[model samples]
Target: MELSGKGGGSRERAALGLTFVLRHGRRTGLASAARLLQLFDVKIHHIETRPARMPQNPAEDLEFFVKCEVLDCKVSSLISSLKKVAEDVEGNREGKAPWFPTKIRDLDRCHHLVTKYNPDLDCEHPGYTDPEYRKRRAFIADLAFNFRHGDPLPRVEYTPQEIATWREVYEKLSSLYPTHACKQYLDAFHELEKYCGYQADSIPQLHEVSAFLSERTGFTLRPAAGLLSARDFLAGFAFRVFQSTQYIRHSSSPMHSPEPDCCHELLGHVPMLADKEFALFSQDIGLASLGASDLDIEKLSAVSMHLILLGRYRTNERTNKAYGAGLLSSYGELMYALSNKPEYKPFDPDVMVIQPYQDQNFQQIYFVAEHFEEAKSQFQKYAMKIKKPFPLHYDPFTCTVEVLDSPQKIKKITSHVKEELKSFEKLS
Candidate 1:
């Protein structure tokens, strides 16, 4: 059976009950599952089966539409039962399944921005389609191709020109960090300089920086071909992984980069990732992005962009805080973003999500978080509005994502780990 369009059946659904779309591997006793739901007074509105896209093993995909005119608790129980039935059908499944919102997985199918060839630069930058730029793009794609989870990060040998570009941006941004940057950023920056070879006349490799962040905040960096769609990029944060580029911006525009480069990733973003509070805040935004509708994803991306751009503005009335890597890394844009000209408001997800953004010029509006903890608290509350079915956690040892299928699973894993830690502490 086919479901009706939004306008046709949405009001009816709301008035009569709420409709939930449930999906699982095909031929998993879906008919039996539907009959069981009837025993609980669940109204099975529709059922459909389709081919699984890139299934691990050959199995059809089944979708069920269930309408329930019951209290919220009852609806939740119904969903819990459905999940159990789905799990039971696939008996003795080995290895934990990586679960994410279907919409987020859909993004993986699209090619990255760096792989696409567009000749029109439009003042964003020069030589996007030039021979040199194309060669650089190929180098980035190679790095991305070689990347594998649970393996050591691959190294890239920088050319003389690339090293020079890194030196120029480094020298310029380092001079401004003492006064313009926040305390957390300053601390992390000092650690990076001392331990990771973040200095003028030298380029810090992605592997080195990733190791630094992993040691400090459980965050790791993966090389990207270039800029990823906001959806794709933010999704990485959910797993405590960051998608970074190894290429420097064109030497001609050392102070400005239309797209994120190694300078921005290493200087602007990496330091914040080292701070536990800020890293959690970043992950909160990522969690919100999963399972979001297309319109919601666009809005969330706008907010992500603004946060990265305006994270470190200096205001006379309040304490100076720099949360965005873009603002922290760019000497020119940092000054412009914190200047008196642009409008400033408290960080509101509702307002920032729909606010317009421009890539050609500095943003005219900025969202100011009072502090990292406040930002984390506020963003966590906002993230609850998003409709996601499962909770996700990263396993550093395996370098894999584990989807918590039930509350019991979350408790079992987390509690067991906690008990082990307690035992170790007692023995010590």
Candidate 2:
């Protein structure tokens, strides 16, 4: 049987099959390869084409399955022949190019997760499609883009309207803090008020807040472009780095935001980060995110946000504070969550990690912790399940990630640091 003309023939083939996936541009070459298979008495079972999921390049790829009862040696020969055809196709397109069959690797999964969530590095929320919102977003993005990891955080000059928005939220939440917020949050809030400019009529700069957190818990803030993927955002916490937005929420909706704004980040999240136990708990969640699959990262992100927003609290009990920023920052939601409306469940890592997240509106259920220590203990136990091969540490001085891939690497890095410290001590 001679196969020719795109090899578009219908034939009944046997059960034994081998499948090969090739880029769409290789379709003509695939047909030619099919002809070679026919010459070798290998029957072509079927051919399938599907669109590639590449957002930037929305092209299609081809898959071909061939049926044959050939020996192992013959199958190897068949693979080599197809590879040659692919190389020839490439050579014709680009001079002296080499082609090889694609192989799946462990890192492919990680790369896919990043690409899936962050197709465009400059992704903006749909609401920001308006020209005015775009301008605000661009301004924030410029600052974030220029920022380097270890340098001092850039100071942002808030417009009068922005300061007004901050003033409104600060005044309301501050009044409620003494009565409704947890003790730890109130303490941190008072400290911030005194030291970091956490008061009415003035917007506190991120550098001041970052410095405050650094002194207290080694947590520092990095400017964020906008709402980041769960994986990317949580990964920062592992390094004691918080990706924060410099932009305030749209002035029109000061109380509500479809996405995170400066008010939500500064007021809702930063206070908890200032608490040592809560900071550790947050980092533990981030540590588990290392080498986690996309689905697991999504679960982790949801759980982290849930804990932050609708923190664990009991009804009519004012002794234990709600540590979640979502509760501490939002006057309405905080009061609503503490009320007798939402179902309150004990903090269970197993259930909470996989629980579906609802961001469109207030959550119907919340997981409550007895205290930050309890939350931290539970989170540590949950983190043990993560099977990342290498441990990661953030270097404050250099502002880089150190992957302790081997014991030797750890010793080398630490010994160098120890010697440097000794030299400084001698000089002093």
Candidate 3:
């Protein structure tokens, strides 16, 4: 946290500090950035680096923190130039909010975020005892770690056992789609079957499915090693990206998966992504996550229990269906949710946002909305209700979060909205 000066002018020209991570190879970029800062007559007050090592790779990264003071007018130019050189430049929060990604490529900074249940960390994980399964998981994790945005999605050759495991999940969920799945889920599921070759016999490659989605809704898939913490997972939704896992569940547990796998993504989320309205809902959750405080982010990630708003939908007293990816993917939970067993409640954001989630079993209570569009409208209203110091807009094209901090910025967004409305009126 940064301390602000008392007077207005002092505040305007206050010392600006940034903390960023850099690799040994990027030291030249750091030197070039320092020279550029000198051009703005910025005074470098302090500089430091601390080692950040992973258990897997002891030589991972050294986080660099630098504090500088520069004139008000030159701040923008200096920061812009710094952005061009640094991997991620985070502003001091009390003096300035720490940075989130400003573009699609910037997401590389997020690749190494903390996770709750990693294979090496959690001995209770299903694959922990099986050396072969552990090796397979590590192989896939390496693929994801090396992958970048524009690179061709890595293709995994599923072993016979892996495919057979996926087949069981596919057959079980497909059998229930007709009776228990929502209208949106059913429609998209069939299209995925027709176009992406979503079948029980085999696993559809991520590249094939990602391309299919990009054409329809602009939502695309990226490979993930395993279950990401909720903050990291939901963060991807802001950019219309899904961090999906390519590995299948262990063959012994074909009826269930403790973590996200190919089954959860292919059978559950892939179909839902085909629906445009649902795509909007996904980004809404992701957009709210950007620029949020750590406390607020924690609340948004777990409380947003996307399943509460996204998964269950009830059109009328007699009709309830599974629309959320969590519900659609789990056969046991799907049947349990639609049964007369669990407590059903109205979709009240204030109430639902505080509810605790227990991941091991079926949720005891479920929140349902009338349908997707209305649910989205209701959820957006609730998301807007989260009071922040500044508002933000996510540009899907640039994949950046535009902070409405200045009057000019706010007015520009307002003017753009009015122009969009005028275009709509012309259509009418």
Candidate 4:
């Protein structure tokens, strides 16, 4: 028998098969995803189809790998040069473009697919004709339209007070690390609202936000009751909006922080919220994951990284399309993940649940879904298996840590600490 089992048909059906196999359990993640593509006759679409084989002895390649940095340096230099060109082009413009210029033409095509294929439940097929599918189509349309310009990011201009605050923070950070990355942070913050507007009034109510998010993103942390309580969770409050805080990674830092800082959480996850099906699926997973055990939460994290990061990694091999905001923000990560060198495991929910991952590196393994519903159905089918009594929990005593604060400095981080505790306490 073939690894993916015999297969061929429409892309949707093939994607659906992949979805079913991945959801079948954790052990088959790579195989299921691989087979799903094959079944759909898209196996060659993955970069990992013929992955780089690990030498019989890894030590043999150690020297070669070390010297490869020289190649990496050259590649980095080329990327930097291209980025400069992109920046120069963007600077001459007045506003952020609706989407990347290269991506603009596909806006209508994606919209058409969503409109024509918005899945519905009332139809003969449960996954293909559900109202939720229509919503997802709309969400995808928004994402395609929003990011079609060369610089799809919205221009966010901050108030004087905000700019001053950022300047102060930058000065303090710059003192410790004299790097140019901090300057980028300063510039980006000052331009907030210009690229990404903050709407205090437009903020969706917690319930409404939770519902919409749940449907699109598979974050089931809404309705605030039952095994999972929306009122008792943090995502219910923090991840409700489509606009993200303006910031960028410190190119100099070697460590990655997990807090959903405004930059990653907002810019990375919010724009896709505009796509209804995607948004709902994401929301469902987020909500469903609330109040889950640490083990389950980790699994959800694995799944998230697998799907979102993998989609991003495979976005431009001229195959494996991407629809997540996180992938959209970083051009380097986006293209590299999908490049000829990376590994492409099949989409298997079972393997995704148990796959070993190093938080430090961009994910080594990725799962691909045929469409939004295939992704959503996996969550719904495995609802209880992944369900939580509350969002992931940590022992306050151990999970919490102290931060340094100067006498004159205001407590910028404690407020969030209290919110976290309150959420836990309510659950308690």
Tell me the TM-score of each prediction against the true structure: 0.68, 0.65, 0.80, 0.35
Clashing pairs in 1: 26-60, 268-325
Q: Write the per-residue lDDT of candidate 3 for residues 338-383, one digit (tens) a residue.
A: 9979888877766666777766777888887776566777777877
| Per-residue lDDT of model 1, residues 59-131, tens digit only | 5554333333422234445556666655312111112222233332233332246323222333346546466
lDDT, candidate 4, 57-90, per-residue tens: 3222111000011121133233343333221111
Q: What's the candidate order when arranged by decreasing lDDT?
A: 3, 1, 2, 4
Best candidate, TM-score? 3
Top-lDDT candidate index: 3
Each candidate: what lDDT?
0.67, 0.65, 0.75, 0.36
Model 1: worst 10 consecutive residues (lDDT sum): 88-97
Model 4 residue runs over 4 Å out of place are 1-234, 237-248, 251-261, 312-318, 387-428
List candidate 3 segments past 4 Å from native: 1-96, 112-114, 306-310
Stretches off by above 4 angstroms in model 1 are: 1-111, 114-124, 313-317, 390-428
lDDT of 2 by residue, 338-428 (tens): 7768887788878887677666567788888776667777767876775555666555555445668799989988898899999999999
C-alpha-based local distance difference test score of model 4 = 0.36
lDDT of 2: 0.65
The residue pairs in collision within model 2 are 182-321, 312-368
